[model samples]
Target: MVDQASRMQPTKSTSPTPLKVVAATDLLARVQRLRDSVARRAYEIFESQGRTFGRDLENWLQAESEFLHPVHVDVAESDDGLTVRAEVPGFRGENLMVGVEARRLTIAGKREAEEERRNEKTIYREPCSDQILRVIELPAEVVAGKAAATLRDGVLELKMPKAAPAKKIIPIGPNMA
Candidate 1:
């Protein structure tokens, strides 16, 4: 309880401090390990979900895989441009309308069948040209302004030019003197 600092003579204080150095390679390896762990965990989740939804996935794949009837449509792309061809079968002029929104293309049209006597002996009946209203969104942006559609030989063909790549800036000299 005595006032030691006020009464006693001052002396120099000395102590040895601890220091440590860490290698950059060790830190990088630790970060890499952490990243790998997270990736592995993500894959594990995907695997579980894939297993659980296997049936639904299979059903969807199968349904989307084939063309069941004449109403089916096909889409193909080449270096020249994009081509959308649909099997309209018997659709007539001015009845089918093609629309383009942003990058999506839609075809909506009605197919009419002339009315027949219901009481008469029914030989047979088919689609009689069913209505076609198909809309597909493009994977990338398209030049919708220059888009064109034509129906020929019962196949609706849509020719679209893919969006041009952005141009680089051309630096100009500063106007200031």
Candidate 2:
């Protein structure tokens, strides 16, 4: 039997961070992009496999791994800005490239290939390289120049301040009667 004081309790933080939210439209677009890329790659894989049947799932999984596997991100919106967190394991902060243009955010990275040599003799060659390039269309307009990003523990977090909505003024027609 465990007493109340003996039971471990979860630590509470003072700061309140809102839950991440991805817009439906953005999610749909991302899915569509993934589907298109995956389809194309899968078709290529199928052709490479001599147009074999009963391997639809295998082809799709391979295509997904090749084309749509990296830079998975979760986007959240707040009154002040948009927050984007991306999972980028096995990558260093210096290897990542984050950019914003118009209403789009792009995340890209590459892993260098490795080669093994024995006594200056080429024995084995392995290409375990990977590249990730993902462009996300923001739900709301943001000031690209003011964006900030940080990479820690294989995760990238970005904050982009929302752009002020455009304003227009109409001339009064002398108080139309």
Candidate 3:
């Protein structure tokens, strides 16, 4: 039997991981790969359904659901900028990447399956990898270079400042012929 005081000891604490900022080009490439994979899965699904012609959308959606986990997100707008919050459970910051373009934001994460070490006989085991990709379109243009992101308690938050509108200047001088 364990003593009460020993059993109540606190566990070790670890620092939070920082999110990785990815270049727009790299992010786009990753997106393209994921799209291709989904397309293949969708085609397989279509073929499995006896070459159905009218269920293209349904097949694509089903394939997406199987390959990617759903990410719940919310966007809030203020007078000066926008804030985005996304729920990404079971993902550490180091496993996540963020990309920001003019009016688009992309978040991607992948968790590799852990190796199993059995000290004793095991009855059953199942290992799998998880991947997530989510892209959001902003209502207003943002200053992509000024975007900041943080992850805490399985939630990712981004603060982006709005871009200033371009102003056209007119010459107020006499025209010379």
Candidate 4:
């Protein structure tokens, strides 16, 4: 018979895989596509509303909601490092990922829904998912390895130390005509 301790021993993986890095150009293209989709949806909404004057902001907000679930974020700079705060309710620390690569900061989160009775009749349902993704180019370089992130009270905060800015010396040219 196998001993209890031996049977309860935990197993470890033999190998680990590295993470993939997304190109900046690809990120930019995805953002552009989202923007275009929002614009088109907003225009359609305006037309559906009988082309009423004013309410541009409302239309845009509606369009954005349709295009993507919004994740409010605030970025601040300090002497120590840059801090990013994001409001992501319905998500726990395990559901979020914050990383910096190629001078770009990426924030991704997802909240999975529990299984429910599928055969039951449903009255009204609003599609919802606690997923959020945003990629932003940092104004200054950052130390990715030293970065830290914390999630509290449904808010996610990240602190990253900034790297020295690149310097360039240009020669003075003769006065232009």
Highest lDDT among the candidates is held by which one?
3
Error of 2 at 16 (Å): 42
Where model 4 places Cα greater than 4 Å from the true spot, the runs are 1-67, 115-128, 166-177
Q: In angstroms, give how far residue 142 of model 3 lies from its true place.
A: 0.7
lDDT of 4 by residue, 54-157 (tens): 98897787778645776788989887688888888888988888879747887777677765668899787665555566667877778899888989998989
Clash counts for all predictions: 0, 0, 0, 0
lDDT by residue for model 3 over 9-78, one digit each (tens)?
9978897898899999999999999999889978987997899899999788766975676688999999
Query: What value does the lDDT take at residue 26 in candidate 4?
Result: 98
Q: Residue by residue across 1-177, what tens digits does model 2's lDDT show?
A: 878875777767889788889999999999998899899878977997899999999778766875746568899999989999999887787778999975899887878756666579666666686666677999999999999998899889999999999999987677666
lDDT of 3: 0.88
Model 3 misplaced stretches (Cα beyond 4 Å)? 1-63, 66-68, 115-118, 169-177
Instruction: State residue 114's C-alpha deviation in candidate 1, in Å.
Output: 1.3
What would the TM-score be for candidate 4 when compared with the true structure? Answer: 0.51
**Which of candidates 1 and 3 is the stronger one according to TM-score?**
3
By lDDT rank, best first, the candidates go 3, 2, 4, 1
lDDT of 1 by residue, 82-165 (tens): 888887777876888888765798776776687678669978766454545566877656788888988888888888888877
Native-vs-model 4 lDDT?
0.81
TM accuracy, model 2? 0.57
Of candidate 1, the 10-residue stretch with the lowest lDDT total is 61-70
